[model samples]
Target: MTPTVIIQLFVFLLAGFVGFQTITRIPPLLHTPLMAATNAISGISLVASLVLAGSNQGLFSTILGTIAVGCATANVVGGFLITDRMLAMFKPAKLEAKESVA
Candidate 1:
């Protein structure tokens, strides 16, 4: 493989390892805040993918960017949804019911 490809592969593997380690080390109590942060990051990625998809670079790039946008959008939405659910778990039943009934 080309040097660039090899370097990229190495970086990808390293990032994956680091991300796994970092996530595993976080306390469960902190996950709700982290999920909000992750959702924000995913939202940023969705915006980036939208830009790429419309960049007019090439057919393949546009297609790949479109897929990325879809995946990132899903991630952002799902993350926020899960975060909201987790936050609700901490609310008193009265407050939860009031909000739900509104």
Candidate 2:
């Protein structure tokens, strides 16, 4: 393998390790914002799908791109639902006064 590929692989592994450790320590509330951002980015996959559809490749490329967008949509939705459930598990109950105000 080329030196550049080896360096890139090492960098990816190290980054993945650090990201895993960081995520493990994140508070439940942080999941809300993270999920929102992830969903936004995943939505961008639709544009990629459109671009792929307009390309000269055969039916296989179009099918793969469509599948990619569908999978991304599922991932974004599932991620948010999971994050919401996780946050619910950790959320503190509101005081009687605060509940009454709402």
Best by lDDT: 1
lDDT of 2 by residue, 14-66 (tens): 99999899888989668777777776777787667767866859999988877
Q: Lowest summed-lDDT stretch of 10 residues in model 1? A: 91-100
Per-candidate total of colliding backbone pairs:
0, 0
| Model 1 spans > 4 angstroms off | 100-102
lDDT of 1: 0.94
Q: List the residue pairs that clash in candidate 2.
A: none
Cα deviation at 85, candidate 2, in Å, is 4.1
Which segments of model 2 are wrong by more than 4 Å?
Answer: 58-60, 83-102
True-vs-predicted CA distance for residue 31, candidate 1, Å: 0.8
lDDT of candidate 2 at residue 99, scale 0 to 100: 53
**RMSD each, Å:** 1.7, 4.7
